[model samples]
Target: MGKPDAEGHGPAEGLPGLPPEWGRVVVPDDASALAVEATQIRRELRRAGSLPGGHQALGLPLVVLLVAVLTTLAGLLAVTWPRANRGADRPTPAPWSPPATLVGRALPALDLVDADDAPVPLRGLLPAMIILLDGCPCPDRVGDALAAAPSGVSVVTVTGGRTPSARPTIERQARALADPAGGLRSFLGQPARPGAATALLVDRAGLVTRVLPELGTSDTYRNDLSVLAG
Candidate 1:
C-alpha cells in the first residue's frame, strides 16, 4: 500500500526506523559520562600545549634536584671510601716543669716548737715555710687556711706576742714557732699595719723565695707546696 516495500530487496526504508541489530545494542549511561570526560581531557591537553614551552614549571626543578643529589652522593662516596680504608694519628703535649731555682734546692734550717711542747725542726724534717703574722686580723686569716697544713707541710706560725699569756697561747695553738720574738709592739715596730701577715714561702733550701702579703689565697699555697713536693 505504501510504495510496494522494496521490490523484494528490502522493507521500503530498510525496515521502518532502526535495524534489529541497532535495537538490540543498548548504550549505557556510563558511555555518555566517558565521552564527556574524554572531551574535557582533550580540551585540557590542548590548553597545556598552548602554554609558552608546553612544559610545567615544576618539572625542571625536580630534574635539577635529582641530578644535584646524585652528584653529591657520588662525590661523598669517592672521597669517603679512601679515608675509611686509611687511618689517622694524634700527638700529645709536653709535660709541665717548675721554676729553675726551686727544683733540686736544699731545705731551709728553720728550728721551731709545736703545741705538744715538742721541738719541731722544720727544714730538717720536711720542705717548710714560715707564716709570720702581726697578731691581729692577719693571724685570724692565716689560722683558718693552715688549719689543715700540719699534716701536709710544716706550718710555723710566728706572731708578735705582747703579753705572757698571749705568747703561750700562740705557741700552744700554732703548729710550730721559729723564734717567738717577744711583744707585738716590739716585733711589728709599735703600731702594726693591716697586712703584716708576711708569709715566707721557703723551699727545701734555707732561702726564703716568695714572701706572701695575705693568706686568703689558700689554693695557691697548696699548689706551690704540691709542685715543690712533686
Candidate 2:
C-alpha cells in the first residue's frame, strides 16, 4: 500500500495477495489456537458417541421391564399349580347304605350277655351260626331252625331285649343270648324292623361268609341253613 512494508508486503490484512515466502512467518499463538479447536471437535464427537438416542435409549428399559414381568408371572404360576392339581387329583368317597350286606366282610366285635348274665364273646364263637331274631318269645320256626341246623355248626340265638321266661325255652333249642344294649343292631349295621330274621354264617377266621334274610316259611329257613352248612 505505502511502498509495502520493510519486506515489500502491504498490511497483514491483505494476506490473500501476499507472496508465498512473505506469508511464511511462524506464530506460536496460531498453533495453540488450532490445538484448542481440535480439542473442541474431539469433545463434540465423543459426546455424540456416548449419548444413546431414539429406539436404543428406549430398548434398555423395555428389556428390563419384560424380564420383571416374566419373573412375576412365573412366580404366580408356581404357587397356584400344586393346589389346582391337588383338587383335580382327589377322589369322592362312595355313599353308605344301611343293612349293607356284611357277607365277605370281617365281623365286628360283639360282646353280649346270655340269659344267665354270663358274657358271651361272639368273636370267640367262630365257625358258628348266629340267628338274630326280634324280641323274645323266640318264634317257633326260628327255634326249630336253630335246632335243625346241620352238625359241626354251633347255633346261638340273639334277642334284642331281656326275656327271663323266653330264655329257658330258647336255651332248650339253642344257646340263648340277650343284647340288652341293642348292640347287635349296631354291629349288623341295620335298623331293627319287626319280624325280620337275619342269620349270619361266620367262618373259622371270624369273617362272615354269608348273610341270610328270611321273611318266608320254615322251609326257606331250612334251605338257607343247609346252604350255610356246606
Candidate 3:
C-alpha cells in the first residue's frame, strides 16, 4: 500500500467487474437521483399505455383500420338513404285510355259515282274531305271549303242525285259525285235536315279525325288541315 496524496486520495485500483476506463468517469452521490427519476417516468408511461414500444403501440394499426371502416359505412348511409326515402313516398301514375269518339275510328267504305253515272274508284285519292251538298244551300259552303282546302287534300262534292239548283258553276267546279243510294249519308250517321252541310275530314291513314256537322267558316277546318298535311 502507498501513502495518501496531498488531496487525501488513495492509490488507484481496478473495480471488481468494471472496465479499466471506468476509473476515468466522474460519478457523484446525486448521479443515481437522475437514473431513479428516469426509471419512475418509464414505469408511469407503461401503466398509462403510452409507451411507444409497449402493447398499445402494437394495436395501433387495428384501431386505425376500424376507424376507417366506420367512416366508410357512415358515407354510404348518407348517399343512398335519401333516394330510398323519396322513392317510397312518390305516387304511381295511372295508365291512359283513348276517348270514345270518331277521332279514333277508321272511315267506312264509300260508294261514289261520277258525272257520267259511272262508278268511281276512290283508291289512292286521299287525304280528302267529302262535302255533303245534299240539302246544303247553293255553292257557297262547298266553294269556301274548296278554296280554303290545303294542297294535298282533294275536295269531293256529293249530292242526293242532281246538281245543286242555285249555283251550278261552283258545284261543277268540284269533283261532282252522286250518292243516290244514300249510302254515304248512312255511313256518316247524318240525318236528313234542311241546310245540313256536314264535312268529313279523312287523313292519309284513312282515319276520320273530324266531323263538322254544320260547317260555316274556313278557320274551322284550317287547323285540322295543316296537321293532316304534315
Which is the leading candidate under lDDT? Answer: 3
Sort the candidates on lDDT, descending order: 3, 2, 1
Residue runs of model 3 more than 4 Å from their true location after superposition: 1-100, 162-172
Give the per-residue lDDT of model 3 (tens digit) for 49-120.
Answer: 765566565456445444443433443343334444447877886543223376756766665787677776
Worst 10 residues of 2 by lDDT: 24-33
| TM-score versus the correct structure, for each prediction | 0.36, 0.47, 0.50
Which runs in model 1 stand beyond 4 Å of their true positions?
1-122, 135-140, 147-151, 161-174, 181-192
lDDT of predicted model 1? 0.46
Task: Give per-residue CA lDDT, model 2, range 123-185, as digits (tens).
Answer: 777667777776224467556665567875667778877741243344445666778787766
Predicted candidate 1 versus true structure: per-residue lDDT over 1-230, tens digit per residue:
11222123321222233335433222222223335545755665577678876558445644544444344344334333443323345456554322345424444343445444455566664445556555444556555545535344555566443211123233335444534543312322233346546555555545545545445666667666554444
Give the C-alpha miss distance for residue 45 in model 1, angstroms: 99
Better of 2 and 3 by lDDT: 3
Q: Tell me the TM-score of model 1.
A: 0.36
On lDDT, the stronger of 1 and 2 is 2
For each candidate, the alpha-carbon lDDT, in order, equals 0.46, 0.59, 0.62
